[model samples]
Target: MTHAERAADFLLDEARTDWHDESLWQVRGKRDTIVHAIPEWEALRQLGSDIKDNVLSNLDTYLEQFERQATANGVTVHWAKDAAEHNRIVHSILARHRVNRIVKSKSMLTEECHLNQYLKQQGIEVIDTDLGERIIQLRKEPPSHIVMPAIHLKKEEIGQLFYEQLGTDEGASDPQYLTEAARQHLREKFLAAKAAITGVNFAVAETGGIVVCTNEGNADMGVHLAPVQIHCMGIEKVIPQAEHLGVFTRLLGRSATGQPITIYTSHHHRPKEGGEMHVVIVDNGRTEQLGREEFRNSLKCIRCGACMNTCPIYRRSGGHSYDHTIPGPIGSILSPGIDLKKHGDLAFASTLCGSCSDVCPVKIDIHDQLYKWRQMVSEEGLLPKTKTIPLAGAGTVLSHNGLYNIMGKAARVALSHAPRVLVYNGMNPWGKTRELPEVPKESFKEWYARTHKSKF
Candidate 1:
């Protein structure tokens, strides 16, 4: 289904829609406050953007460099050209180790590759240790938000989920209680895990180290306990130097959750004694995306989610409507690159508001990329006739001055004198959630001629 159709389904719940919108806005406000406190926030964003651009421009060199350094640090590295290969490589490692169960921290890359489902199919039990991830895993739902995987659900909904799955109290809905319950349940999973998997937040070529930023330290716990550790990262994740990490660290937490820093920024350099560490660097269509000059800048995303929190369209529509691992404005641009035909409608799911670009920590031109995707989709004859036919007629009217003026005057007259029922019915999508403005007596062109003619 198209994003609009799914979004319509989400909007059916009026109270939920309002709550989601307000909740994201509150996070946006928090970001504004925390970011302003940093005197060099914009500078940091620019630096992060620059570093990502440099890395994208020279990904091949950095990826090789990282592999060399990581190998020297006693870390085994595997390269996968696609998701299938990445999943196979990871499964092969588990199959070799004869690992029956694994615990994982939140990793959008794993979500992108659908790794958990793959592992489960191979009969290797997979448990997501992150609280939000665990909640969604038990419910068998994809994450609705990147950082807050269960943000789409309410505490009451969670209480019910826990009641059924975790055996919580009949009506217990307190955050602390639920969290403790999750922690205890996950602790068992962690200790029993034969292997652990994490997503790499950043990989430094200089030191052959990867960073995992988390508030709960779940990644650390899983890695520490599990004898076999796997870290999955996209090729774009590699940076040239360790120093470049500072720029992203300053911008990431603030943009993602409006905090000065993540509670635990754990750097995994190598394995513990008698333990094994594996880094899986997967292309998974990233190389193709980087080849598109107009869209290459999108690789600069730090996954801070500032754009998602600030986007008006995303704030109201909810992330599930996007139907991609990454959602919101950034996903609109990225998804189309992966499959234009299936995701074409996503580009039009925006107001073209630059708020997303303004808030992006790495300064990706998200809205501009959305516009480019829209042009590509339309040029490919991907838009349905319902939109194309009306747009074609509007284009004709807009191109001719006389036709434009006539249509403008007709609209003003109809809006002024026509019955409210005629104006607010099924034909008017804009009227569903908005009021028509007061009609002006004259067209701006007409007023301009009358007033400016004398002056000229």
Candidate 2:
């Protein structure tokens, strides 16, 4: 189904949609409050963007440096060109260790690669140790948000899920109680896990280490406890220097959850005394995006999810409406780059209010990229004829001044006097959910000419 169709289905339950909208808006409000409190928030954002720009510009140099330094630090680095290769490398790592059970912590990279499903197919059991991830894992669904995987669900639903999956109290819906249940449940997985996989928030080329920020400390627990620790990072996660971390670390939490910092911001430079560490640097369409000058800036994303929280379309439509791993403004722009034919509808999902770009810590022009994606989709013949035909006709009329003036007058006259049935017909998609505006007696040009002609 198209993104619009899926979004329309989501809007069927008005109360649920309002709840989703308000929940994200509340997060956005918290972010605004925290960001405003910081005297140098904008400066920090600029610094972060500059750091990423430098990284992308010299990505190959930084990546090789990171690998060399990481290898010197006794960490193994693997490179994957695409999703299938990423999954294979991860599976091979697990297979090499004869690992049957592994625990993972809040890795969106794994979601992108569908690593869990791939390992499961190979008879390996993967447990998501993060609370939100565990909830959705039990429910057999993809995350609805980047930071909060299960944000689409309610406390009661979670209570029930815990009741069924974790055998908690049948009707307990308290956050604290449910959290305790999850902590106890995941603790077992941590203790028994043979290997642990994590997503990288930032990888420092100078330090040859990766940083993971999590409120629950699940990533720390899983990695530190496991005998084998695997860190999966997109190539774009690299930064040129260690000092650049200060800028990104400052912006990440405030932008993501309005906190000064996550509860635990763990850095891994090397493996434990007896443990083995592996880092998979996956390209997975990132290099393709990098080659596109118009959209390369999107690679600057730190996965803070600020854009998702501030996007009105995401809030009202819900993340599942996009039908991709990363949804909302960022996802809309990135998904088309990955597969324009399949995800072209995502580019048209927004109202282009530019709230996402305003909130982006890395300063990615998300709305502008969305507009550019739409044009690219059209040029690639991914757009449906229904839209292309009308747009082409409109373009022709708009290009001719006489036709434009005649159509403007005719439109105003028809809108002013036409019957409701004629104006609100099935052929007019906009009329389905919106009322036609009342036409003024004169067009703006006509009124301007009448009022200012003598002065001219």
Candidate 3:
């Protein structure tokens, strides 16, 4: 197996532990009750999903309209077809400004495109300003959770990481003290950075502005303080108008962290007085995804991450297990489209419990996408050898009543004396951590004939 596959398998193995998986499942349930308090919750979700769908369907026209409007407002707009194109566009902007050091707010697009590494390779220094992202960055690891990237690391682990990296006292483990220490350290970087890059949470097509939601005010601080500000957004992130912002903002934080809303929701219309502003609208396979009717709705994701927080598979396996920048249920569905053969296993990682679909603020039908991706991936010959034949045979048998009855009888008889361990081979992914259900003798149909039919 390849390194990526091993990492994925290891994550899946870890997810099978009951305590680990069930915790996130509870978080999902809690979020549902919170959302249920609002009567228009379902309507808001449909509206949000509809808006995104409309924008994605008319993506080219909206993108062009956004570019024209953004340009008219004195904000430069650049288009990138892929990751390399994205990096070059960003690098060019930074190079033009002679910016070597940058302070960045949380932007998943950057992580997805490996922007930090690319900037480092270009001899530019980048600092992740989000507290969770900062800690993960200092440790040289990818963010483990979407909103709380450092969720996997305990306070003690963070203190240790900080003490080693920031030259703090050896055992300082208090969260407040550590937070202040990081604040002071980042304060210096914030004051010094010539440029700042932020991710666009929502872009308003009507106004030609970008909306960013942040808790720490880092995105505001970075963009407001820096001489030059750059914002990167997926092409599908554009909303029709500013009026729609209220619907998304209401759902975003409540679904994500259970907060009523994030502390700061900043809109950038033009550059800070005399500062330069640029927006890099990225396609990066989003348009291709939009072309698929069955899967296009996945683009409605507001990145609330409630799906991840509530996902049993995500909690058990953790984000790093996905081996992609975006992790959890959303990542599993999204990754296969980017590279089907390499990420094929991710589609099968879920139990199809539909919990993720239930928690999504925008109601992306995440579980449905996961299911569709499985069929599409299998058709593309991405299925691993062992799964292909048996599942296909089962499908064929289940389609015919007589064949299924014969197969059921044979299976029950074969399983009657079979060793428990034999049923759980290495080939069975679920068998690694979960016990197989015991097989009972005689078919339900046969039992019904023996009991209910005679009575009738």
Candidate 4:
């Protein structure tokens, strides 16, 4: 099914859809409130954008520099060209360590690579230690949102999930009680974990350190306890210098959750004593995306999720509708770059209102990129018949001024005098939610000529 069909499934539950919309909009409001108080928010965004530009422009030099410095710091760095190699590298390390069970913090890169499923097939019991991740993991569902994986689920649903899986009291939906239940449930997994995996928020070339940001500090716990630790980082996550880190850090929290900073921004310089620390830098498709001129700016994403929080379509449709690891406006652009034929429909799932671009921490031109992708989709003949047929007619009418005017006149006549059934029917999705203003009898050009000719 296309994005619209999947989104229709989400919209079937009007109550849930409205609640979901309000929940994310509340986060967006919180983000606006916190950011308004900051004196240098825009400046910080510009600085972060500049730093990312520099990093993307010279990513190779920085990667080699990072590897050298990291190796010097007693950290082992491995490179993977894509998801298969990435999963293989991770599984090989686990097999070498004889790890039967492993714990992981919230890692979207791993989700993109489907690492948990791969590990499970290899008979490794993967436990997600982050509370939201653990909820979805137990339920055997993919993350709906990048930061809030279980945001699509309600507390009552979680209560039932915990009741079934964690043995919490039936129908106990209180937030604190459920949190305590999760804490007790994950503690054992953390203590027994043989290896821990985390996603990198930023990797610094100057100091050869990787930083993991989280509100729950699950990544810190898993890394500190496990003897074998792996930090899975996308190649685009690298930065040029340690100083460039602060700019992103400043923008991340306020834009993400209205906080001064994430609760735990842990830095990993080296492994724990007698433990193995592996930094797996995987390219999956970053180089391919970077080579594309129109979409490369998306690499600047800090994963703060501010754009997702503010996006109207994402708020109402839910992230799962996008059918990608990272969802919302940023994902709409990035997903298509990876497989335009498969994800082409996502490029049209927006209002092109630029709200997402406004809230992005690193200032990615998200909506513009979505529009570009839409054009690319049309160029590639990727649209379905429903859209392709109408757009073909629209193109002809819009290209010539005379044809556009005649079509406009015809539309006015139809909308004005046609039967109600003709105007409101199965084909017009736009009329489902709202109606247009009354059709005018005269065109703007005609009105201009008649009204202003004598006076002006």
Q: Could you give candidate 3's per-residue lDDT for residues 144-224 as a string of tens digits?
A: 777878876778888899999998888999989999999999999999999999999998888899999999999999998
TM-score of each: 0.98, 0.96, 0.91, 0.97
Q: List clashing residue pairs in candidate 4.
A: none
CA lDDT, every prediction? 0.93, 0.93, 0.86, 0.93
* Weakest ten-residue segment in model 2 by summed lDDT: 430-439
List where candidate 3 sits over 4 angstroms from the true fold. Answer: 1-30, 392-439, 452-456
Using TM-score as the measure, what is the rank order of every candidate, best first?
1, 4, 2, 3
Clashing residue pairs found in predicted model 1 = none
Stretches off by above 4 angstroms in model 1 are none
Model 2 spans with C-alpha error above 4 angstroms: 421-436
TM-score of 3: 0.91
The weakest ten consecutive residues by lDDT in model 1 span 242-251
Better of 1 and 4 by TM-score: 1
Which candidate tops TM-score?
A: 1
